[model samples]
Target: MSVFSDIFFGGLFQGSLYAMMAVGLALVWTTIGVFNFSHGVFMMLGAYFAWQLVAFGLPVVIAFPLAVIVMAGAGWILQASVVRPLIGRPNIVLVVVITTLAAGSLIENGALTVWGPRSKQLPSLIEGNTTIAGVGVSLHQIAIIVITPLILAALWSFLNRTRLGLALRAVAQNEDASQLVGLNVTALYGLAFAIAASLAGLAGIFMGGYRFMNPSMGADPLLKALIVVVFGGISSISGPIFAAYLIGFFEAASNYYFGLYWTPALLFLVLIATLMVRPEGIFASRSRGLA
Candidate 1:
């Protein structure tokens, strides 16, 4: 019973974090029709930035916002300078992808030089563990579990209520149409990139605190986010969250029965099997032309 409880809550917490990490990527993918391969790089940057701030004597709370701001600014600047100009090129999607990939490599190498190969541990927001359903859990995990829904709710409201978020969505639906209505599509794309980068960075902050920071840490999160995005449906905001929980449940089950060594293989298998059934994703309303 205790082991089952552990798996349940553990999977839930882990899935929620996966959703959080994937949310930013979903935004950019749905809006711009391009996946920022370097999404994980920004997450890595956020963790490192926060670590540095804490080392410099800032309180953890203060360090978080500063790191988010710095990363968000960088995201916005990169979109403006590097990505914006390639908007109309032939095979722009491929070009942007390669650019972001290159950027990611550069960022990773830079982090290696600056932070070295040694991984850094982040101080937890709240010390100690608490009991849940007869199992002990870290406060960070519990916080992640609780915080994810709130974040999702806030995101839902932002996209549905705020003028800016609506504008971004409109641009996503029809860039030319949005421009026809006098919306600045380029500006909307930049804003989308900034928001996506900010969310990824914020996720990184919690992740670093829960685990340890390393230059290569972003790759796993990025891959998971891609899977969740595809599984959930690019067109629906709720898709990533739902898919994340489902994957989390499956992962927990695999961990309990199959052991750690088998988890990765199982995840890939699940990805492949699901893609075979619904390449457009479970949440997509219509086929994305996979057939």
Candidate 2:
């Protein structure tokens, strides 16, 4: 029973973090029709930004939000400067992959030069531990479990209920049609990048709260998020969210039965098998919109 509880809660905790990381990737993929290889660097940079602010004597409340804002700006700049020019070019998909990969490398090196190789930790929002179903868990974990849904709900409302969100959704569905309808497609693309970066920033903050963060900390999460996104399907936001939790639980079980080192190998194996069976993803939709 104790082991079962550990797996259950551990999976839930990991699933929440995976959802945060994967959803942003899915958003960018669906909106721009390409992947940002630099997405993980955005997470690393955001966490570093928050850590810097805290080190400078700012509170976590202010530092975290500001880090997200800075990341939003970074995202917009990346879209405008790097991605925008290649939008309609020949072989743009391959070009974007290369460019974003280069950009991510540059950013990671920049982070290393700026922050050094030392690992830093962020203070948790809450301190203490609690018991659930005969298992002990940190309050921070509980907070994360509770807060993740609320953030996701707010994001859902923004995408489904707001005008700008509807516009984004429209652009995702048919970019040419959106432009024909007088929508500023370029600006919307920037907005999509901005939102995606901000979410990645938040995920970084969440991870930093519990784990020691270094310049390269985002890479693992990035790979896992890619797996979750591919597994969940990038056609809609809901698909990745469901996939995140499912993968999270699977990861927990794998970790318990197989051990840490074997987990990544197992995940990749599962991904390969899943792709062989369903290349489009388990919950993939025929439609191309974020809804």
Candidate 3:
């Protein structure tokens, strides 16, 4: 029972973090109409940015927002300068895949040059741990468990209650129609990318507390985000959110029971099974049918 409680609660917190990362990817897909292979790069950069800011004498509160804003700006630039140009070209999906892969590589190499190959972790926001149902959990973990839903709620409010959010939804539903209605489709795409990047940045900042930051850090989250997003539903926010936590719990439980090495294989198995059974995802789409 003790072991069960440990894995359950530990995975709960960890999976909430994963959900945050996945949510960013899902947002980009739903809005920008492309799977961002470079999403993880944004996360990596965010963590590094925060560290750099602190090294330069900024407080955590200030550093965090600055890092997020920087990442968001990069996302905006990526969409505006790089992605937008190729979006209408032939074999757009393939082009985007190549471009983003290349971009990720560049970002990784740049980080290696700037921060070196050694891994680094951000300072913990809180010290010590708390017992939950007799299971010990760190303050950082508890913060994650508490904060994810709040962020999601805030996002929902923004999306449902704001004009820009409505414009974004309009563009996502039908780009042509939105443009025909005199909407600035380009700006919407950039804004979506910015929001997505900010989410990734926020996840990165939180993750820095638990894990070491490396140039290749984003690689894992990118894969995880893809898995959750695809498994949850492509066109809806809610499905991926649910899928992230489910996958997170499964991963933690599997790691505990099957050992660390087998966890990857187990995750792949789950992904394959989900793909076989529900290729369209476990959740319904916001439109005609679940994407």
RMSD of each: 1.6, 1.9, 1.7
Candidate 1 minimal-lDDT segment of 10 residues: 282-291
lDDT, candidate 3, equals 0.84
Per-residue CA lDDT of model 1 for 1-291, tens digit only, reads 998998899789879878987888888887777889999998999889989999999998899889988888878887886688888787888988899999899999999999999989888867889897899889987877887799888988999999988998898788889999999898888888888888788788889988879998999999988888888877867888899898888888898999989998999898888889987788777745322
Off by over 4 Å in 3: 285-291
What is the Cα-based TM-score of model 3? 0.95
Write model 2 residue lDDT over 96-181, tens digit each, in one string.
99999999999999999998998999888798999999999999889988988898888889999999999999988899999999
**Each candidate's TM vs. the true structure?**
0.95, 0.96, 0.95
* Candidate 3: residue 87 Cα off by (Å): 1.6
Off by over 4 Å in 2: 286-291
The lDDT of each candidate is: 0.86, 0.90, 0.84
Worst 10 residues of 2 by lDDT: 282-291
Report residue 175 deviation for candidate 2 (angstroms): 0.3
Error of 1 at 7 (Å): 1.4
Cα lDDT tens digits for candidate 3, 1-291: 888888888678767877888887877777767888899998898899999998899998888889989988988988886689987776777888889889889988999998999989987777688887888788988887888899987887777799888888888888899999999998989998898888888888888888999888888888988888888987878888888888888888888889989998888887888778877787854356333
Query: Highest lDDT, which number?
Result: 2
RMSD of 3: 1.7
Scored by Cα lDDT, where does model 2 land? Answer: 0.90
